[model samples]
Target: MGRSFTVYVAVLAATGSFLFGYDSGVMTDVIESPNFLAYFQTTQTSAIVGAINSTFSGGAVIGSLQGGLTMDRFGRKKTIQMGALICLIGAVLQSAAQNLAMILTGRILAGGAVGLMSMSVPVYQAEVAHPRSRGLIVGLAQQMIGIGFIVSTWIGYGSLHAPETSQLQWRLPLAFQVVPALVLVIGMIFLPESPRYLIEEEQYGEAMRVLRKLHFDGTNDEWIEAEFFEIRRTIEAEKSVAVQGWAPMFTVPQWRTRMLHGVAVQVFTQMTGINVIGYYQTIMYKALGFTGNRNTLVAGLYNCVGPIANFIFVVFLLDRVGRRRPMLFGTLGISLALICEAALNSQNPDGQRIGYSIGGVFFLFAVSVIFSMSFGPCSWVYMAEVMPMQIRGKGNAFAVGVGNWAVSTLWNQVSPIALGQIEWRFYFVFVAWNLCVSFPVIYFLFPETKQKTLEEIDLLFAQRIERIPDEMTQREKEEAGVSAMNVENTKLHN
Candidate 1:
């Protein structure tokens, strides 16, 4: 029963991610329909279209920041439930939108909800999971995001292809997002609060109960107690060093440094133009070579590939290769692939050659796979792991929020314009964005987070370890009555 309960909660919480993907990807099919656009002319409709598309992204940024603060105050379950309600509202508005403004309003509300779910779900999973399984559990949210993308793309494709009388096509698909949001709200109502949250509130007994519930194997209660104590101690250690609000996060050297890395990784991931691929693949496929259902089929295939790649990489290699290396390799590889596509597209300036266009689109699909296995899922897992718990919620929210806004501003708006005007240069922009910023961010800002406990990662910034020790060697320092390397190193040598 305990194990079932835990699994159920994880599955239910994952629905929020599905809604995020659905809303983002649905537009790909919707945008192509002449009926949909005939209602809104170019003169008055462009701003509303941008507003509708960008609203969710903008809301996600705000929601992410608010989610962090709210998760601390109102438990994870409630935060997600609120998100579900917001998604329901957004879905309804989108399905029934008479004007572009109502659609934008709906997207804003839905986006904010997804923002909260993104932060709260991983935090809850991390707090409840065993130390050995922590990476896997927290990584579940990443995997689910991929799954959400796949499902949304296929559904959108099928819906778009249904008979002309089938209002069920787009309308039903958009409405379909509401069902998952509804499930999340109901399931979360009975879920337990994170043990860490309970402990923070000084309710040790309840925290223990939640711990026992999560770990059903009758694992030693002593281990749980020790973990609790360690958590408390770490929180205390962080109190002196942890920055509060924008001042410390933006101004303090160490926090600002880490925050920059957080921000950069997210930006790189976005500029990889992955979401643009997810949301615009159908259009891109049609533009390049494929048409009608063939394009939709290819788009669906591309969507399916991303999550599968993510599952394999995250499940098998994440802990092995660590965070920074994968990110470096992924961004570089994606950049090169995009460069190839850019060159190909540039050669065929008119976008008329079917063979060349198809080849370029295939290369783009390949790039998506590279991103999926490397940056797509791994980046979020790394971001969640790197920030200190003290300001993790807020710091990540702010960093990711900025990235989301960048995505919404660039990918959402620029994509249509780029496709309409400078098609070849579109790929160039993404290629340059990745090559220029990706390496510097990984080299200087991002820290190694392989095999280290979350508690240990937090200490890196608090102690300001100019030179970070490998996780294996870091343990040796703990044996000498210290976690950091300063005084403990001399004592160990003696």
Candidate 2:
């Protein structure tokens, strides 16, 4: 296989991301369906609607937390395959639901699968890609995520209008998501395991063979030797670090700090109100008094456009603009846009500004582009890249699961309050959330991981190796318990 082969493989793995987008976005349309209220029997008194909406997030949390262990133990390919199967099952269950519980059950199962994919796909890609092209290749994961959002938004909105032919309306859109999962399962059967994973498992010959395929030039023995050593050194280093399970992560300050960094990034991504727009755009529009299906249609169209724009911006400028500046600049843009949304929404009452509501919707969508191109995809890349490869699965899983479910729960819990009390002012909380947490996380805690090799990054946390301090903060002091040998170990293979 050529470089194209690996790229295509990444594309296939990333296709799982399409399902992630679809499953996540599926509910956006469901909320608007006439059948949705009757199907769930939502009422002012009933908590079922919130339960129905939050259950999937709850399930995703379970899935994401489990995904890291599953990926490490079972290998990325099998874990992904399992996730796909789960997705298919969830789709069938949701499509066949007669009551709220059934639909929620289906969503829970599907959401879990998506949660798993969100963690696994990038881990797999990062493990396989050549160091030189790593950024672009890993970035494809985000690109697919954008595509996934766009696809599901369209499906959710378009299906509402589909002529009633054997339930081609809403059910068809939900069911159709299964096709991608099914294809991923079949395709993954032939897909190779991460070469690094194979090496860690002491399947060196197989690892070498896989590397031969990934490297594209089989004759390059020196490259193979360096790659092989790189894998081996990482495994040896992990042995000293005590990276397994929750114990190592919690006890070691350095480990815990890194984990916290992961959590912070994930939390920041959510606080940006990315999901608020992606999931609840229709409801938000309705709050502005834009009635009928047109609001949903417009919201969906915005999602589709935003991702395309995001893909173009991040894909091209990622190298040129560098990580810190674009993310910081973009965060400022999102905050400003969010403030505008909050202000616009604030004006809706007292009939003070019926004029601003429509403009606010447009502004919210504009904020979507800022998020999609900058924080949206780039955040995932930073998360996967920053964590030490040893506990990457757990770190990523924890961050994503916690972040996603937290947002889902927050939105479900507070959306009603926001709608009921200060509907416009509701977003103000998120604006504050973004400004306070996001900026510092980027400025203080996070490192610029772009264009660096994994081993070089390991040195950032090593004791003896003193790299230049980032303008943001001192090079994080390696914890006391991290012995000389441990530092040596990280330095040896990374």
Candidate 3:
């Protein structure tokens, strides 16, 4: 068991992310269903519709915060199982909803479930992954998200064929969320707990066993021993200074900086206006002159573009290109696309021009393509990898909960009204944010963490360096006949 095993566990854990994507994406088409709106007796821009979207995000905020504690107390694997179970319950309620109250309640529960998994999955992946492939492993969270979006959009598009009054159009998609939730719940039973967590719990034997299975390549016993020694030393050092329960996140200067980076990346990800398009792409398509099933059809096709780009980035570019440059490039590209979309929308305010509609759609796809390659996956990757083990669960939760879900709730609530009343002008808000705020922050503050181990990242942020001990270096040299410089380099690379 080596890289293959790690990938297997990461993929299984990402089913939680898949549920998050499905739950979030399913509503894009659900609210667009004519029967759904008529049955609820509400229009797409209605406050009730906004509440439906906002409530899920609101629940997610609470869930993310709660999940941080849950993962810390019970471990990453159990937290994921708990989230999946909650999602399953929510999916059942949503599929059987008879009124707005019922549906909103279900969405709230589902949102909580997604929030829980969103915080847990990436942290789990980062903890288990070899540093050489951590970006790829952690980035799987976003790739699975893109896949979830694809599946939901296509299902939503297919549901358009149902009889006009059939509630199945939305109900079936809502129900479909249950399948992945069930898969995630069961899959965790076979997965291992994070070795770092085991070490923190003082289960040294179990931790060593896990490290061996995760990193062993038959002739790397010395390397395995060296890594175990480093992890134990770092964790012990952290334990000596670790404050109780979230205080250090705010009180410690280095931890505070880490928190800022985590929250800022997530907040900026939302500010990119990706969800504004994702959660309401059908509505945007409608405003662009698409009618009936055409809205869902175009949305289905549009949803496909992001995942393909994201997959390529995660596998080939993420580690090679690192995090900062891609984020800068992505934000710049998104700004340009948004500008183009705004001009197109402004030119075709009446929604009568085909060329403008085509341009508007093209720019929308451009935004997705750029975002997928840059911020979409990188945000999650950066947030998960940046924190110390002690604060990782709660710190990540705060960032995702406050930065991602809280901001998302605001946007999800206001976007329908904004798009309806202001139209093209709404695009400028994100453009300004991208150029004035997001770009400058990444350029000035963010440091490269690619190809660095979790412990090394700790040193990087703490403004200190922790070299491998001379004794350990000599031991490795004697045991494996590896040079001290070669051993140090391997440690840094991993």
- Please tell me which predicted candidate would have the highest lDDT against the true structure: 3
lDDT of the structure predicted as candidate 3: 0.89
Better of 1 and 2 by TM-score: 2
Per-model CA lDDT versus the true structure: 0.70, 0.72, 0.89
Question: Lowest-scoring 10 consecutive residues by lDDT in candidate 2?
Answer: 472-481
Question: Compared with the true structure, what per-residue lDDT tens digits does model 3 show for residues 1-494?
Answer: 98889999999999998988888898999888889988989999988989999999999999999987998899999999999999999999999999888899999999999999999999999999888889899999999998999999999889868987898889999999989999988989999999898878867667878888888888876777667767767777777777888888999888888988999999999999999999988878888898788888889888899999999999999999999999999889999999999999888877789999988999999999999999999999999878877788899999999999999999999999998899889999999999999999999999888988888898778643344333453653444334566545555224
Each candidate's root-mean-square deviation in Å? 6.4, 7.4, 3.5
Cα lDDT of model 2 by residue, 55-143, tens digit? 77777788888898998899888888989999999999988877766788898898888888888888888888766566667778777
Q: Which tens-of-lDDT digit does each residue in 292-368 have in candidate 1?
A: 77777787788777778777886787767777788888878888888888778777766689778878877888897
Q: Pick the TM-score winner.
A: 3
Runs in model 1 lying further than 4 Å from the true structure: 1-8, 42-48, 163-166, 240-246, 349-352, 462-494
Rank the candidate models, highest lDDT first. 3, 2, 1
Better structure of 1 and 3 per TM-score: 3
For each candidate, how many residue pairs have backbone atoms clashing (under 3 Å)? Answer: 0, 1, 0
Distance from true position, residue 215, model 1, in Å?
Answer: 3.5
